[model samples]
Target: MNNVINWFEIYTSDFDRAKKFYTDVFKLELTDLPVSSDRHSQMKYATFPVGVNGIAGALVKMDEVKPGAGGTLVYFDSAEINDELSRVEAAGGRILRPKLNIGDFGFIALVEDSEGNLIGLHSMA
Candidate 1:
């Protein structure tokens, strides 16, 4: 089988807060999975679709795991990095770094979502 990232999970303290952050910023739909007796409150997760036919991930809550300022770097494709950067603030996210030209590689910007997750945005010139 070809090697590919099937999915990723972001561990957070509050599922509802994280869900709102992601949904507002990325325009993603988050659906909470019903709690089961076997799992109890041990497992809480929500899935996020990155793109059409693309890899997806989930938001999980683990009491043992503490949220960090930096953990993962998720890149999203954008046609207009500048415009997206503007939307970041309105979406309750902060721009860690403004869009910068990367020579032939295109443009990239670093941003922190409302939940404090650092993510990157990329656009091909």
Candidate 2:
């Protein structure tokens, strides 16, 4: 097995609002993905920029899927977790937990995004 997780999706009810929230929080500029004919009319999605070695994921708006604070949690790579934590509230998010040492791993913090999605931030600093 090369990787346990190949891709991830953050489902949202409001595509534009969620897109804005993510872009503002992580400074991510997402791009629209072309949906197949079979799914085009039913859903819409935008993907985060993929680095040369980074994983791929997307923000999806579909009738069956709903975004919230439960289920899978996605931890984003952070160069400065504290700095990001400071911006959470201003970005329309709430800090669920402050940055704390994770033994030999580094530091981690939890936050709830504007769309009510619980997300994690990890950093080595």
Highest lDDT: give the candidate number: 2
For all candidates, the clash counts are 0, 0
Instruction: List model 2 lDDT by residue over 22-109, tens digit each.
Output: 9999997998865542332366768888756656667877554467855345778777789989999999999976775544345656
Q: At residue 96, what lDDT does model 1 achieve?
A: 78
CA lDDT, candidate 2, residue 52: 62
What is candidate 1's lDDT per residue for 9-123, written digit by digit as tens? 5778777898899999988688775433232136566767655756556676744344665444466777778878989989999997677554444665677899977776767
Q: How far is candidate 1 from the true structure (C-alpha RMSD, Å)?
A: 14.3
Model 2 TM-score on a 0 to 1 scale: 0.51
Question: In terms of TM-score, which candidate is strongest?
Answer: 2
How much lDDT does candidate 1 score?
A: 0.66
Error of 1 at 90 (Å): 50
Candidate 1 error regions (>4 Å): 35-41, 69-125
- For model 2, the superposed segments whose C-alpha errors exceed 4 Å read 37-41, 71-125
